[model samples]
Target: MNEKLKAYRAAILHSLADPSEVGIEQSYQYFEDGVLLVEDGRVVKVGAAEDLLPTLKGVEVVEYRDALITPGFIDTHIHYPQTGMIASYGEQLLDWLNTYTFPTERQFADKAHASDVANIFLKELLRNGTTTALVFGTVHKQSVDAFFEAAQALNLRMIAGKVLMDRNAPDYLTDTAESGYADSKELIERWHGKGRLHYAVTPRFAPTSTPEQLTLAGKLLAEYPDLYMHTHLSENRKEIEWVRELFPERSGYLDVYDHYRLLGARSVFAHGVHLCDHECQRLGETGSAIAFCPTSNLFLGSGLFDLDKLERHGVRVGLGTDVGAGTSFSQLQSLNEAYKVLQLQGKKLDPFKSLYLATLGGARALYLDDKIGNFAQGKDADFVVLDYRATPLMTYRLQQANTLEEKLFALMTLGDDRAVKETFATGQSVHRRG
Candidate 1:
């Protein structure tokens, strides 16, 4: 690799493991004045500035004074096609989909419109310091193609798939079982494993896909075991009831996918707010993951997600800004909502754990932990630079913080896009705050 080496100097913070598994101090790595060395888009070394600076004598060094550097936030689940309709008028999940989501997604059938939204959506993600996400595209193959094209241009590590909804959706937004399978296969071949891009086989959910469509989706998933399976689970009570009505033969909503062989280590279901004990056990045993969309759940009147219960069952969970239903693109804002949601459940979400969910936990949920999460040597050099004194309120609050925990608490509780001073992808500066 003949790539030039670059060194970044700043305060560094990252999670090495789940706080629950290891104590806060053991799982958290922080250096007051740190230096991260990168070459060919991978971390070469990370440690105290005094230790690494002397070694990087000839490398280019970029310094950010008093800023906190962390792994770029990972959104475990988000709908890229819903960029235009985020924060639509309040409605329940099913109604919200019909009133706002389906219609907005229908426009993506036009490649030009798809490309336009793709660019804007990606920039918005970068602006919010989210370097990676498992995104949902529209039913149109062009939408997924356009999204991948935009991400590839920026050398971003993105996972996306064209949605498959063969029934229970508008004609313009649906595809038959045969067509859905074929389209997903074509897209998988064209985009999966290309540079930093990967493809997930996306079936909208049990409600949108018929029995035949679900079976075919299962076949596609089985064919490419490495690809991710993205879909919804028991997000809303009404949606769950409707799924039971549709697949009465199955014991529960999650069983519908399990019966079709879609439950696995690579499957990541969104909005598992109302799942039962059996569902949680099944998800854990299969190594499946859930993208807990607190903002979207709260916006759509979905029930509270029991993080303690999920963890007790050994189920893996990550945070998502399920945009459109979710109100913000910023993971810090998402963490803000997650904190409240857990509070309502009579549980306290620790500040350290909150940061873990957006970084390492999200990568673990997507089964990409080995590649992108944290500042481990040989990992991809994707991270964010946060300015603690970004706003007047934060500047005042941070002055009172004397400990690292206190500082991180202030960042998650009070920070947003303005806190993101810069975003880096593969050792390159992708977005700098203007």
Candidate 2:
């Protein structure tokens, strides 16, 4: 018996390529009755159970009936400090930040509060079937310290950074250029490339950061080997106008970050809902990525994102819940809104395409595809088991699904946290439905 090995038998599916690049039929692989083989916290293989079961002489196989297994969902953009204020009432981008976000983030100055919220945040992600996320902390250094401590305790692959807001924010939540740089550099030194955890140099947005702070953020990326740059971009029309007013020398909103040398393969900009064609082309040329936060955009009256335009320009895109303004922690809910966003633009979001955005697309956007996305051999075995019969209505609806695509579409449209039966990270069960 190989005690180090574990296997799960279920209906398994995973994305192999983008449907936009490969045809829909060739974008994914699925097995009606499949076996996922794991050993020592990594994937060994995934294939039909009939072909795999006979080869396993003395390994234990956990069978999940009426469930589908797939790679764990990834959230490319979310604010961990704003977890407490998720669904806060009406206000656009700027007002929302001043009203709900800043006040909520201020509490993170208390290490205990930060730790408490970190616990709740991670649990909620697992409950919603999310295993990896690029997160935001408050301006307080202790906030990131607390978050990393909690994430380390669980051995999860998470990325986060302390916010850098020098101006255009409440005084209580602001940090000077030097202080922000020193704090971020210290955090990068302590957390980046530590176990399964990474660090992101998070400047709140172009409007919040001064040229000096943005330069320092670029410096941090230059100093570190694999550090990430996470920030907001072009979410609201007024926000764009404000950015233009702040940085009059720059051509546009994206140029402000570009002039500071912040564009790169590891950079992720959230809510690029209002970018122009030139901006999209520059992003693609620089190999930068965007976190498509559909729910937040719709909730805040931000404009619809042009996923087709971004794709046509060769940009990489991922799904982001953008919690606090995003209205839901479940990626399924994000996908539901994303479907509507694309529909409004007269574009179709194929079920396979939606699946890719939530999983492999997110991994590629984060530049961690080799480690966390899909069931590729030697990749971390992070996955979720989804119960098709999570509710009576869902069960009834799925029974009428005539094809796999229809079934997947129904799951995204009608599902929420309830659809997540279990979630695993590194081959270990981290969440199980009661």
Per-candidate local distance difference test: 0.93, 0.94
Write the residue-wise lDDT of candidate 2 on 201-239 in tens digits: 999999999999999989888888578999999999999
Q: How many backbone clashes does candidate 1 have?
A: 1
Which candidate has the top score in lDDT? Answer: 2
Runs in model 1 with CA error above 4 Å? 1-3
* The best candidate in terms of TM-score: 2
Alpha-carbon shift of residue 192 in model 2 (angstroms): 0.6
* Clashing residue pairs in candidate 2 (N, C-alpha, C atoms within 3 angstroms): none
User: TM-score of the candidate numbered 2?
Assistant: 0.99
Model 1 scores a TM of: 0.98
Where is the poorest 10-residue window by lDDT in model 1?
1-10
